[model samples]
Target: MKCNKFLKGISLSVVWITLSICSVSANENAAEVWRFGLEEIEGSVQDIYAQAFKRKIEDKSQGEIVVEIYSYGMLGESEDLTNLTANGTLQLTHASVGILGAQIPEAQVFTIPYLFSNNDDHNQAVLANNPAIYEILGNALIDQDLRLMTLYLEGDMVWSTNKLIRKPSDFAQFKMRVMNSSLVIKTFELLGATAIPMPYSQVYGSLQAHIVNGQTNPIFSIEEMKFYEVTEYLIWAGQQKFTTSVLANQAWYLALPAPHKLILNETIEELTPYIFEQQIALNNTQLAAIKKSKPSMALIRLTKKEQALFKTISTPIRQQFIQNSGQPGQRLLEALDKALATEK
Candidate 1:
């Protein structure tokens, strides 16, 4: 009987060992999941892009890749998301140059007011994927342990203010909410407003509570955040374009299997034009919604002369950016200029 019991135990041990081996093999071949984060909520350009990317990646990989999305504040603020991505805690994130500026100082060049022309072709055709520009920005990002997947625009930034602000002088009495970036603060300060550096998440409350009289963002942001309800003016001065960089954890990206890497590159290229069109549609629809909801709110588009006045003061900030970012920042600016000039 004792011999029979020992034999039964050995049989059970073999069964357990076989199960363990199979489990390990299944896990090895299981689908890989990627986390994609957005700095804006649903319906924003970032959200649209991420959704398209998620679909394409999953489809192309035939279930080998899966994407889980986190949109605005789900994983914390913009800077936090970038940190998570850089450290490999988050696989990917969408962030503005200002958010990236904290870690990648050279990225501050994009925060320079009027840096790109107020033309779609200039922004989309040239600046979006400019080899000269990304080559410099890419090196800067790699040092920060981030990879630039793509650069995209939400829309032209407009001021949601309590009053009309057509010229720099008109900003005399304004308290403008700017991102927590020195360049952005300096840009608004140069424009004659008392720039208050704050997190993007806090801007709505600040505006509603009168902590700040105004903030600058794309038309979709004003509508999405319902800023138009509190602010009395929508001033389109074209101070800057809201360019967001899609980033990946550099080390993780480098380690991706060759096919996975190919899938990502192909996916981004496929969605580029669609993403641009969606931004335009969102801005147009949202702007109309804001005006229809608040007929009393003024929609102020600055005349060329009025915009030029603000642009002139903005020039000094470019020199300031070069000083802050040093040689690399200077290169990025030069690259951007070369691309824009080439396009022109």
Candidate 2:
């Protein structure tokens, strides 16, 4: 009887151990299948970033974490993705600063027209020795249950129009499609154009129908969306240097193991320069392609004086934004200004 009792106890112990092991395996498996989504896949940016992110996650997790990417609005629109991420329904998203700014008004500072004159100027302002600006922006996002993982790429924005935008006066009677941002709407209005806020997906159609005469976008988008086919002129306003952020749901990110998180952060840092290089190359190539394919399309270069005139007209809009965003926006603008000055 003593022997039988001892044997029963040992069997029970073995069963408990098996169950615990299975439970752990299940939990780890659950964490491994990560879902990453992007709004569009029109360029190699999305592809390269996704690949790099997945590789890092997998490597860091020792093959325990696998990331699946959905692109081209496969999951939903940018706003929908933002909401889902905030609620922890989605794992990750890559969105332009415009969409991010709409959600977190402080991000709008990046969208301020002519915020950075050129890529080097913008990189110097945001990239090197700039902890405060990124911290403020990332913290603001974290407050809303999101993590700003990385600033993925910078693309130069220019105005595409059917008419020549030779000077600020040329914009007097123009109507352009602007994103749903008060700053953007006001900027165009201040620049002497009628600003029509619309979804990006609709901009192409609007331009096709002649409902709006012009819009601004990066060269990659102009080539990918075939915007050059509809617009006869491309004015190099460089009005906004576009950037995107890789965001993760806070809950999901927090659930990750310490090693996994470290891996992701490190990977993002390593991949930043490569992504930036590709973006610059693609933008240049697309511009050349547009010029070659559409020989009639004119690329307008604005003089320094003209750019200054445009900025002067748009100053009031910036003031209003500062007033509306209150201290946070004001602080962000101040930080950006300081960074820009330090760069020079």
- Candidate number with greatest lDDT: 1
Runs in model 2 deviating more than 4 A are 1-31, 117-129
Work out the TM-score per prediction.
Answer: 0.89, 0.86
Model 2: colliding residue pairs = none
> Scored by CA lDDT, what does every candidate get?
0.82, 0.73
Candidate 2: tens digits of C-alpha lDDT, residues 143-260: 7888887775457778899998866788787889987777888888888889998876788889999999999888888888888898998888757776777888877788888877
Worst 10 residues of 1 by lDDT: 1-10
Q: How far is candidate 1 from the true structure (C-alpha RMSD, Å)?
A: 11.5
Clashes of each: 0, 0
Candidate 1's TM-score: 0.89
| Candidate 2 total steric clashes | 0
lDDT per residue, candidate 1, 1-344, as tens digits?
A: 11121122233443453355346545655778788878899888789889999999999999999797888877666776776676665688998988778667888887888777657756787656678667888887777788888888789989999887877888897899988889999888888999998878888899999999999899999999999998998888877888888899889899999999999988888787889899999999998898788889898888888888998988999889899889888888888877666533
